[model samples]
Target: MGLRRLAAGLLGAVTATVALAGCTADGRESACDSAGGIVECSPDQRSAAPKITGELLPGGTYDVANQRGQVVVVNFWGSWCAPCRAEADDLENTYQATRASGVTFLGINVQDSRDKAIAFEEGRVSYPSIFDPGSRLALAMDIPPNTIPATVVLDREGRIATVIRAAVKQEGLQPIVERIAAESPEPAGQR
Candidate 1:
């Protein structure tokens, strides 16, 4: 689909009550739902995964465009997001087990100060994460405004294959990543 149409569709979707603003017991923003959870894009509905490039938490830069031909897992999270913390270990474990299969994970940290975010991932998580102090990367992914702890799995062609809203579990995510990683590249012009 054209960018205009995509934008329009996303706009329409956004109006459907994806997130509500509230405070958790800890006084952190509580974001829930993804309008309706994973927006599945048909083959015809596929769009190139948004280009992502930024300074990683520990060091170096990460560019999503460079991950073409590999299945890429993009997870949006924040230090203050309780669900993010709940799933962090599961995500890291999945990453470790799947790396040999050519699956890569990129965490996008949003709405947290650099120090706190880095501290959150320093020892418990092993994957590199983009420190998005602002929501630029989230906006690029067309994430519903204010939703954190969302995950997007990109197919080998770099098109978005699946999106998971809310916290992710290993049981739910492993099969999806394996399936994408195992797919043979589409023939020329077939993608």
Candidate 2:
């Protein structure tokens, strides 16, 4: 059973890497670089993020399209995941520090009851989260956050810029958020 789990985990990682390669039509090299589980894409290689609209945890509807012209950080998490709980405060701190620079953080709670997810976020994060019990939003992403605690950073133009497939620390995530936020909103000429 343990060996089967290991094999499944490896297969998932390979699949994710292939999916994220983002090769161009002309067969150009992949525009993404994966190092230490963090995948960063060059501005010219990014593709538009899929539309993500969902119900907010407590109330109201949230739409990712409305956040154009801002660097958006989308986190996929579940209340039952230990790593999700461990990174909650760090995610919140990074959001608070980068919001002034046009960065916003959105959480997608997956595979958990509304009550538990809401309880988990009570004092840990100030930003609103979408209730995604079925992971519909995750499936819609260009680079899906397949792992709990994964984070995808969208550039100002709502393009996938970076994906971190592990629980993040404020120190590491804040810099990436700030850098992407500093990029110009003008679309790059190269595809």
Candidate 3:
């Protein structure tokens, strides 16, 4: 009877531990739901994205926080990455289609020289890209872009709504951007 009692206690403890693993320290659900390489979070489940401010390749500064009222699509890329090159046009197309709806696209060029990165962008994309040879900005994200051609979509409230950890095509990415863009912005006073 003592052996049976111990076994029951151990099983209960294991179950509780597994359940708690999915919760944050403050008892909120931890991390976004991920499926087939795409990670998504509901508005209430989203956490604020890390501050992203940097120098643009051509010349200018950008602060993601300043784009609160717009849905922002951030892409992490490198001039030498084949996948990044392959997805460039698709990203530009999606950006053009969604920009009228208050959607903005920003790229972070990682591990590439300014001249090379600029050449890669010439005529490929209209949106501005930040010059980040060391990938500091990418590393700062809550869900860091572990891959060279990752994309993160932020809601109007500046919270991370979706993360795609691979090259994205226009057909696959446009719907996600449009869905997030459709969400109503928070009241000015609430921000």
Top candidate, metric lDDT: 3
Model 3 ranges with Cα > 4 A deviation: 1-30, 186-191
lDDT of 1: 0.77
lDDT of 3 by residue, 1-191 (tens): 99999999999999877653333454323456878678888887777788888999999899988888899999999889999999999999999999999999999999999999999999999998999998888767766556779999999888889989889999999999999999886676765
Better of 1 and 3 by TM-score: 3
Backbone collision count in every prediction?
A: 0, 0, 0
TM-score of 2: 0.83
TM-score against native, each model:
0.78, 0.83, 0.82
Q: Residue-wise lDDT of candidate 2 within 77-151, one digit each (tens)?
A: 999999999999999999988898989999999999999999999989999899999998877666556678899
Task: State residue 29's C-alpha deviation in candidate 3, in Å.
Answer: 8.9
- Put the candidates in lDDT order, highest first: 3, 2, 1
User: Which residue runs does candidate 1 get wrong by more than 4 Å?
Assistant: 1-36, 142-146
Pairs clashing in candidate 2? Answer: none
- Could you give me the TM-score of model 1 versus the true structure? 0.78
Q: What lDDT tens digits, residue by residue, belong to model 1 across residues 1-191?
A: 69999999998777554433322233222222224565555445555666789999877898888877778998899999999999999899899989899999999998888899999998878778998888787666543324688888888888767778778899888987898788787788875
> Candidate 3 local accuracy as lDDT?
0.87
Model 2, residue 27: distance off in Å is 9.2
